[model samples]
Structures are given as structure tokens and as C-alpha cells.
Target: MSATDEQNLIEVSGLVSHYGDRQVLNNISLDVRENEILVIMGASGSGKSTFLRHLLGLKAPSAGTVKLLGRDITTMTRRELFDLRKQIGVAFQGGALFSSLSLIENIELPLHEHTVLDKDTIQIMARMKLEMMNLLDHEHLMPSELSGGMLKRAGLARAVIMDPRLLFFDEPSSGLDPVTSAELDELIKQLRVALNMTIVIITHEMQSALNIADRVTVLHHGDQIFTGAVDELHASSDARILNMIHRRPSRHGVDSDYIDQLTR
Candidate 1:
């Protein structure tokens, strides 16, 4: 094996995915190294979320290989996938906490379900994770009682409760104020060093992507458009890449037919 193969926690090669007749990902390939932060960026409908799902083995691709920790998850049995997920963590966009469960309950649910740790030990471990997220004080609060930032933190606490070697976060900055978003970005960066984790984040926020990404993979209409360091992305001359970075609308001229219809 090459040194790159030895270091990568995730390796995708020529991945093609479809939802019925609609293609969602097209010939995408990327590698995520151990302890690095890889941010996947694309606008809505760009297939980044699909890419993230493929990485997590939540959906099997129509073709190509997705290897996580030296095993191809695309071909893993159900039981094997379950075992593999024990070493992976995912924080969804909405926090996805049960409204009926309190912060501590939500955070410790994984342990209670997956392990044989005693109640007190589970609570301690959960509390430690909450403390790391600066949420220890809100341990007993219900999900509905928390603010947007608080909810994200609570969800993050749960995600890292098991200290998974690979962490996948979806839109950590979504709906957050600038201050909260920046704080979350810092925390994400710290997690890489603190836990020695390989993190893959899915986001459309350019600032957040630039702030936390060790490397970035950008998609456009299901195609892998760019994959490299932030500096390289900045230097890219591609019109689509430039439009994304600058948040400009795509250049499509108004046709005479559309204008005539509008006049009618």
C-alpha cells in the first residue's frame, strides 16, 4: 500500500450514485487523512449532502468504492455496518434531539443503548462531553428549552460522547448568529487536535468552510469540481468555483422568448 493509503481514514474512488432515475453523485473521488478536517461545500442541489451520506454508508452508491478504515462500506453487511458505525459519529443539521428528552438524556442515549456502562458512569461520561462543549450547565434542560446554539452544542456533545475516530458534521453554522457560528468553528478545529479525529463537515457557508477546513471538496451539479487546499480553491479560475466563492448568481442571459412571454 502507498503511504497515502495507510494514512487515509476515508477513500472514495469513482463514486456514482442515483436515486431511481436521477443521478445524485457522478464519478466523485476524494480521500480524507487521519486527524484532518475535510469540508465538503456546494450550493443547494449540488449533491454535497448526497456525498456526505455516501461517506457515512447511510446510502450505497450505484457504482465505485467507499472505503472507511480499510473496509469497503459499500459492500458491508448490515451487521458489519452497525459495528463500523460504533467508531463513527454524526451531528445532523437540526441537532435531531428528541423533544421529549432532556439535554443529558439526549447526550447519553447512545451509551445507554450501545454499552453496558452503569447509569452513574454514563452520566459522568455524558457530562464530560457536555463540559467539552461548554454545555455542562444546561445538562438537565429539555431540547425545546434550549436556544439554537445550545441545541447544536447539545447535539455535538452527543456526537462526541463515544469519542469516535471519525466525525461527520452537517451544517454546524446553519441558523446560528455570526458569533455562535465562529465559536462553533473554533470548537470544530479544536476537536481535531483534542481528540485526534478525522472530521468531514458538509456546509455551504464559505466563511465557515474556509475557517475550519484543512482541505475542501466542492461539487457542482453532482460533479466533483474542486478538491484541494483552501489556497488552491481561492486561486481557481473556474467560473463556477468563482461564483460559489463570491456568492454570485450564475450568468444566464435572459432569452428573447422569456422576455416576449413576460411582455404578453
Candidate 2:
């Protein structure tokens, strides 16, 4: 591979996915460079979530390849895949912390499961991550005790506790007030610089995408319609892109034949 290719932390080429008879992704391709934040945005049912799943190796693509940290996931053995996951972290939209576990325990779970670290060492490491997220004082609290923004930060703390090389966040700004969402955006950027990690965020919030993304990729019905800098995205005259930016309904009306196929 060339040096530029070597620098890519994540690469997806001609990826396709299907759910039963329905095709969710239509030949997508993208690259995420090291320490860069790439935002994937699309309306609901636009396959952004499906694409994230494929990237995470939660689901295999029907065709093409996904490479992460110079490894082709499609060809990796189960054991190899398991090892690959240790270098990656994911923060779900709802934080996905276990209610029964304290914040510190949640962050330490990965260290305990993935490494042979002792209890004191693990607690220390987890607390360090909590400090990074500014949640050291709340480490003893359950998920229910935190506010929405705190929960998101706590999830992020757990995600980066292992010092992952790549981080994926699903809708980090979802369900947050404007000020809190902006704070989260700043935190994401800070983490990338502090950890030197490649970050991928899947979101529909246009403001968040424009603010945090070094590059933005817009998905329309599973197809990658746009991938470029925020200014280019704003300058584009494409109807789909404009509709997405302006929050207008899709111009492509659904046809009756497609509806019939869905029913059948």
C-alpha cells in the first residue's frame, strides 16, 4: 500500500448490504484518515446506521471490503476480529451503559475483560478516563443518576478507557439541548486531538456535522451522494444535498411499484 493508504485508519470500498430482500447500502466507498473526524449524516432509513454496523463488523457486507487499521476485516478470522476490536471503541446514542453498573465499573469493564490487569490497576485506569471526561466525581453513580449529557460523556469515557485507536459515535448530539450538544461537539474534537484517534460520528444533526466534521459524507437511500469538506457540502447545488442541508423533504417521491414490492 502507498503511504497515503497506510495513513488511512478505516477504508470502505464498494460496500453493499442487504436486509432480507431489501438492499440497505448501494456500493458505498469512503476513507477515514488517522486522527481525523469524519461525519456520516443522513435522514432516517437512509442507511447511515446500517453502514456503521458494517464498519463495526457487526454485520458483513454482501460485496466489497472494509479495512481498519490496515487489516481487511472481511478476511480476518474470528480470533483476529476479536483482537481487532480491542483497538476500536463505539459509543451508542443512548450511552448503552448497564444501569446496574457504576460509571467507574462501566469504564473498567473493557479493561477487565480484554486485559489481565489487576483490580487496583483497572480502577486507576478507569478513573483516569473518568477524569478525562470530567466525570471523576460521578464515578460511583449509576447510569440513572446522570443527566443526558453526563450519560453521553460517561459512555465516551468508557469508549476511550482502553485508549482505542479508532472511535465511533452514534448521534452524540441526539436528545441534547443546543448548548449541551455544542459542548459535546467540542469534547469530541478535544478527544481526537488528545488521544490522536480517528473518529467516525453517525448523525443527522446538520449543525453538529458542520461543526465537528473535517469531512462530511451524506447518504441518500444508502448511496453516498456527497463526501467533502463542510464548505463544499454547503456550496453544492445537488437537490438531495440541498434538501438535506435545508431540512426539506426528499424530492424523489416514492413510487407505487416500490410500495407494492415492500408489501409483497
Best by TM-score: 1
Task: Show model 1 residue runs off by greater than 4 Å.
Answer: 253-264
Per residue, candidate 1 scores C-alpha lDDT tens digits across 46-150 of 998888889989898999999998889999999999999999999998899999989999999999989999999999999999999999988999988999998
Question: What pairs collide in candidate 2?
Answer: none
Candidates' RMSD to native: 2.0, 3.9
lDDT for 223 (candidate 2) = 92
The number of clashing residue pairs in each candidate reads 0, 0
lDDT of 2 by residue, 1-264 (tens): 899988899999999999999999999999999898999999889999999999999999999999999899988888999999999999998899999999899999999898999999999999888988889999899999999999999999989988999999999999999999999999999999899899999999999999999999999889999999999999999988898888887646668788999999
lDDT of 1 at 52: 87
Scored against the true structure, residue 76 in model 2 reaches a CA lDDT of: 87
